[model samples]
Target: MPAVGFSPYTLYSREEWARLREDTPLTLTEADIENLSGVTERVSTDEVVDVYLPLSRLLNLYVEASQGLHGITEEFLRKGNGKIPFVIGLAGSVAAGKSTSARVLQALLARWPSHPNVALVPTDGFLFPNAVLEDRGLMTRKGFPESYDLPTLLNFLGDVKSGKARVEAPVYSHVVYDVLQGQTLAVEHPDIVIVEGLNVLQPAILPKDGETIPFVSDFFDFSIYIDAAEALVERWYVERFLRLRQTAFRDPAAYFHRYASLSEVEAREVALSLWRTINLINLHENILPTRQRADLILRKGAGHAVESVALRKL
Candidate 1:
């Protein structure tokens, strides 16, 4: 276990980590991963390296550990140890860089010696289409747990973790904000499958009838929650909104094209309002509460630096 900081719940100072875990043994070049995930222009966040890099290595270790355990336990049903998928769950609030962190980890974990078949499956794929949400009167709660196809998501994870001969997950298009039925992501039996989304750790929302159901996180050998203060996350949302207003929203075919040309003041207002109305509510009621269920927590500082990490004690 890593030494604790002044606080009992936190450990890993920036200076101490930088010295102990320099970015070495990374097969992926910086040029390929220079820009952090979800960051279009550029980012100056300190957590990009010091925190995420070590976290990536830690995940790799977890993958290896799971493999060891699996081999010993499944003596009868065993096959040759060529490669097995390592599914990781990445969860966080809006503007917390959960998507970015997910992409970064996918790349990092793939480059690791253990798993070259690393693949990413964002829960965005399971989000109900915009029209469907509108039909259900849930357009306002787009990212909320209720807006997703929980059954499909759970089944998808089951197949991924089951070592199925072939598994396909529906692909969701952002422009349309719907799952393209019959369109699927083909997995050639990945060595690692990283599932990223807002409520990946949420328990299965089952019917009242007495029946057992496997929650998505139940299959996750290791899960991470990217955490940040409310204020910081709000600021990031505003900044990202403004940036998108200038770029993606400008695309005529973009789903958010209506947001283009929003003035700085108007954009900030919209961002704040959305955060207060939708994102914040989801975070408080569904997302944030699941943080305790995570195996690791990446707590960010004001400047988006991962100032501390909390790992559940074995």
Candidate 2:
């Protein structure tokens, strides 16, 4: 580690990071990118070649090293425990394009023969049901730390790390804006598991009794935080809302269907209002503070394109 005043990360410009790709092949096509992108976002092949390919290479190396270490530990203990999956925690603000990043990575990482069974699990599934939030009077605080089922999330991670044959994570529906009952995403023994969410990197509160507390990030073999200027993220959120108003929000079954009939100006105001009252508050109070805790940070600029990468020095 560097001295206290020195930065822990080695900052890389877009060009500088692209050079790290070396001879890594581009396995994704334009159609594949279109399928991996978010509703209001599009990930170009250049972005995949320049940004994600190198990341996939780095993660492949890390997974190989981790698997070797796990094997060594098992041999030393004279126990033949099964292979442990590399758990990656991905965090970012809403509309920051972290979902696209997660999907892209899942596709790219799965292409690597060493870890073909990569799993992508979003933490939105761990959020308390809408009814539970309404009863707790936390409907407006939807993305806040308190709005999640922390114990369930923690147990799920623990089971995954323990090499369980299969672990089920609750399924959340963006259409209904709630956790779906009797629905669960079954994660079979994957070689790598990418867990994405808004507050995945948030630290646990310490108890006065000095008890051990395992945070969601504690199980991560590596972690990434998608970052951008507050104003930029807000703009993306509003843009996404406007697009959704014309699309998903028009569906009668969509949870935000009421917003579909609003005038453009009215929709913009509502989007800004939600940002100010809830999303912005969560970003400031919880999300932004956890950025430095990530092993890697992808900073986005205009058009939701990643402008820079900061990787913590090993």
Candidate 3:
């Protein structure tokens, strides 16, 4: 561990954190990792062993504790074992590799015998449809908090935490860049639910009537924020954009199909412009502000490799 500091987090080097994975069995193969990783994001089995195995163990400890606490509280209230899902929130910038983290964690946590049923929910599904955003004139601010249907998202999560069964959420399509009409994702009873988004940790907005509304983070049993330098994130975003141009953007059905025909220089210029005008603004104004609210922070270095870990002090 690094020397104790004045910060509320205890920092550990990658070497020190990897040791915490002692005796934790590795079940994922290279193919599994490749399938789970996002475009332009590199995640090796070695990275999983060093970074995520310890994270899984830590999450298991928290889940067990939360289950026990829920039992005691329910007994005190004269209720039955309703089995509420343990919720985890993951927040990060656009190219900070949060999707890969959520998928990897879902895969690893499901392998634990104690919690075989895990569900992953990307909050993109909660975003308002493009049509709705256009009506509100928020198309340019798509990833901002205002673009989401906060009431519906809050209700869905509240239902999950209340042990409600068969709760459904709208499904968003990246291919078309809109919420799918008449399509929904059912989140049945599960041992754990991982909610990943850029604004998962954002603070709640006060309504005009001054009635207090619950923030999404209020339901989280644990939260994680993936961090990297802004310059590195910008570079990653540009690289990912270039990769998608040759792959997904080549599909006529893709929302960004127009980018497929651009030359490499033109593609890079477009990506940089988008980063400067939209993504960077969102990162600075919303995402990075909530970093301290996370229970754990994974600091990434070049090549998307996690260089250090900071676990919040109890």
Candidate 4:
């Protein structure tokens, strides 16, 4: 918690937040955490029990309230009951551990008997294909807001929120560094959908024609922003890049295969350069500016452990 006064959020330390877990049961095992984690982002069961279990419980309350409101509105309008999925937007920088948090939430939320149908979608799938980006001269600006197929992404969300039984999202391959052709992820009717990405919270851009456009966050019932010091995130990014050099980069099909044979010093230099030019720029210019739009912000400290939570006040 910051020592400053007059904040829009009430901060809670890790110990204080962990006590709110109360009677929430822990269902995830160590193996489950291991499988869900990314290359450098690891989540322990203790962290889940402390940080995410309470979050899941809070989300359940929000879901129940939302359903109740939907039922009331339907009855008041004399309309038939319609089911809409509760959407959660999880946004953060590349190395801030948002992926691990999303996976953890998905696992926890599905365990609840009230809403067992949960779907996790990464907005990386919405990125324009490499060829398309190159054609548009946006290859170097990949991961920027302009680099995504926003209209298509919005339409998919619209269909989901309109109670569509099934919607398909394009598949993205990190190894190939592009949208996979002829591959799509089918999302059925889910009680909850977690959309994780680096730019989900960005505000809608106004068109010159004066037409209104809905931002992705507009459809979210709740949004979380994972945050950490910029220096720490840069270090994490460089470390992950180095680690991938020895692992994923070794694969001939990997887009980053060129870095596989580089010496440690050379690899670190390249990674640092990338961080300074691309990822950090995106974080400062686009992502971090949208943090205030989040319903909750998880602030991570050294080693990627959440130190404090700042939740929006009612």
| Best candidate, TM-score | 2
lDDT by residue for model 3 over 212-263, one digit each (tens)? 8999999999999999999999999999999999998999999999999999
lDDT of each: 0.78, 0.94, 0.94, 0.93
- Residue pairs whose backbone atoms clash in candidate 1: 86-192
Residue-level lDDT tens digits of model 1 in 1-314: 98756432445666655454555454455565565546432434345467666777777778889888788767756766444567888999988988777777777777777677888888888888778899999999998999998988888888777787578877987654567877988877788888989999888768788686878898888888989888888888888888888877788888778878778888889889988999999999999999988888888876566777777766
| lDDT digits (tens) for residues 2-32 of candidate 4 | 6876778989999999999999989888888
Model 2 lDDT tens row, 240-314: 999999998999999999999999999999999999999999999999999999999999999888899999999
Q: After superposition, how far is residue 205 of candidate 2 from its true place, in Å?
A: 0.8
TM-scores for all candidates: the values are 0.88, 0.98, 0.96, 0.96
Worst 10 contiguous positions by lDDT, candidate 1: 39-48
Span of ten consecutive residues with least summed lDDT in model 3: 1-10
TM-score of 1: 0.88
Q: Model 1, residue 72: what's the lDDT?
A: 76
Cα error of candidate 2 at position 176, Å:
0.6
lDDT of 2 at 182: 99
